[model samples]
Target: AREVGMPLKMARAVQVGGPAWHWANFAKVARNFEWEKKVGNSVVVREAVGVVGCITPWNFPLSQITLKIAPAMAAGCTVVLKPSEIAPVNAMILAEIIHDAGVPAGVFNLVNGTGPVVGEVLGTHPQVDMVSFTGSTGAGKRVSELASQSVKRVTLELGGKSASVILDDANFEAAVKGTVSACMLNSGQTCSAHTRMLVPASRYEEVRALAQAAVARFSIGPSLDEASKLGPLVSAAQRDRVLNFIRIGIAEGADVIAGGPDTPATGKGYFVQPTVLGIKASDTLAQEEIFGPVLVVIPYRDEEDAVTIANNTIYGLGGAVWSASDEHAVKVARRIRTGQIDINGGPFNGSAPFGGYKQSGNGRENGIYGFEEFLEFKAMQFKPSAG
Candidate 1:
């Protein structure tokens, strides 16, 4: 809690206990997969992709590291990790744990530095067989370009400007409240957070009011304070980046219904107010990943417009759709070009696939799909002995 203002309760969950749980899950899944198969006169087999370069983001520092490292190790691939400089302590602690657990020294290595200096090497290194990265879209693009030089396998889970679609027939209050809560989770630092909200135009006024109410309920304070519901951004630069996005929204004539582009009263830390903006799909706020407790509610004329708005972003990471019927919501969800979408505020499923589409980045993470990213396939052919 003290190191970076991670919520007191969530600090343990995110840094310590959560990583532990995920590591065990990764181990379990790793052991259960079939390594080889026989077809006709041939046997096909899976092998480690050799050395893997893992570049993780700071938002869910430990958890993201665990996601990349666990599966890479499970696939029998050696790893070289470069954690975000902003929250590198967790990676150090995790290294200690790995050392204590007696993992071979060469199997895993940690290098700490800025993305430009260290990340570039990981992406371009010829010895590294694969690279898995999680961060901004711009950075991911650079990673891809560098990795392409060596023809290395690359999997990226990058930025998102996901939307929360509330159908006219859905539970309006529940959906609005849930969307606001999700947008503010981790103080909105999450890459997959639903930062945009799409609702029927007829209910714009109602949604505005509901969104305002929900924003008011969030209490910002020092992370250790029991009453605090939100905390500071990871660094001052990040805080300024989010505030700049909010300012752009204002200049673009978007409605600031909840919070504004002002620094919070808690002057010491990088705190942005839990804000909600009413805007059109073309507004900057509706398209960018502000990475703060900010939400943009863009009204849609109908179901078609809602789907159109949801798919308008350069990102296609995560999203949500709410409807009276589960089938209706699922139907709408299928049309949205996102990696994952919540139905009626469904909970995050670690066991399911996660990642993105389009500029949000390529490849899936989590579950068996993530484990497969670090493996290569080979086939051996032989004639049958018996005629």
Candidate 2:
């Protein structure tokens, strides 16, 4: 409760005048399952029908688990949670919290294991009615295929290769700094991080210098430190994956304009310095999802070219646009194929729908959008006075 409250307060402080920025708001709405029926005229019509399979990732462990569990409980559905083994400790803590919260036995269960073993089992299990997965596009595909045999409803929030387009008219310093920070947040593990930066060729050198300096100034260290702007990759395997992408960026001829390789002399945990790569529009790094502290900076001739380069990737989960004029930025943002686009460093609203396009996956989460995922719609008509 305290941690949730803190996030709410922080969001309110940052967003100001936004939606009811309180944890109580979430709890309150979560308690009201009838609201869905009232609005959509849809109901489960069957109580404790079957089990819900929740396969969550390591990032944002508690929140993701809660996102699945809370609604399932409200709908009177039992759940079998398979949280990522890399972050299983938090799952244990969450299971304790749910148990202490007085949720009934057999209503919520936790299974700790890898994706291939536990996740596949849960997805393919005949008794499970639905599966909610949050992971990579590759994993999401497999989960969907497995669930299809049972004809179970599936919801997925998968990988993203987001782009941040800096228009020629935008403030070069602010745009570069914001894009760099977005790329470095969560050590760039966030599915919606703006990893591909599109800049006008006229301001390419100027933006590159600013972004390079910004990446150099990021503080990478342990998660417990409040001052640490970045944390180590979740595990050694993730660290290696990120490092391999960095190597690929170099091999593909993307200029290492900023931080690269591992942090020097940091022996305790897995750490990679924030890296920035300047590549041509056609480079492989410019079109791939490097889910690390690696930014691919591509130069474009104009707004049209910038939009083209930004939308050239297979993933279209999220993006950003920066320009001197809000109207111009909005116009450019509309051209991108991403599900969500931020203009001028605007805040992210949890109440809005969040998902992706293309290989980034389908469907949405959060607000009324997320609530409808578990629902089945049926329309009925009655002929009056026919008798």
**Which candidate wins on TM-score?**
1
- RMSD of every prediction: 1.2, 4.5
How far in Å is the alpha carbon of 121 misplaced in model 2? 1.7
Cα error, residue 183 of model 2, in Å, equals 0.9
Clash count list over all predictions: 0, 0
Each candidate's TM vs. the true structure? 0.98, 0.88
Q: Model 1, 143: alpha-carbon shift in Å?
A: 0.8
Question: Which 10 consecutive residues of model 2 have the lowest summed lDDT?
Answer: 1-10
Q: On residues 120-201, what C-alpha lDDT tens digit does candidate 2 reach at each position?
A: 9988999999999999999999999999999988888889889999998888888999999887766787789999989888
* Clashing residue pairs for model 2: none
Candidate 2's C-alpha lDDT? 0.77
Give candidate 2 regions above 4 Å deviation.
1-26, 30-50, 385-387
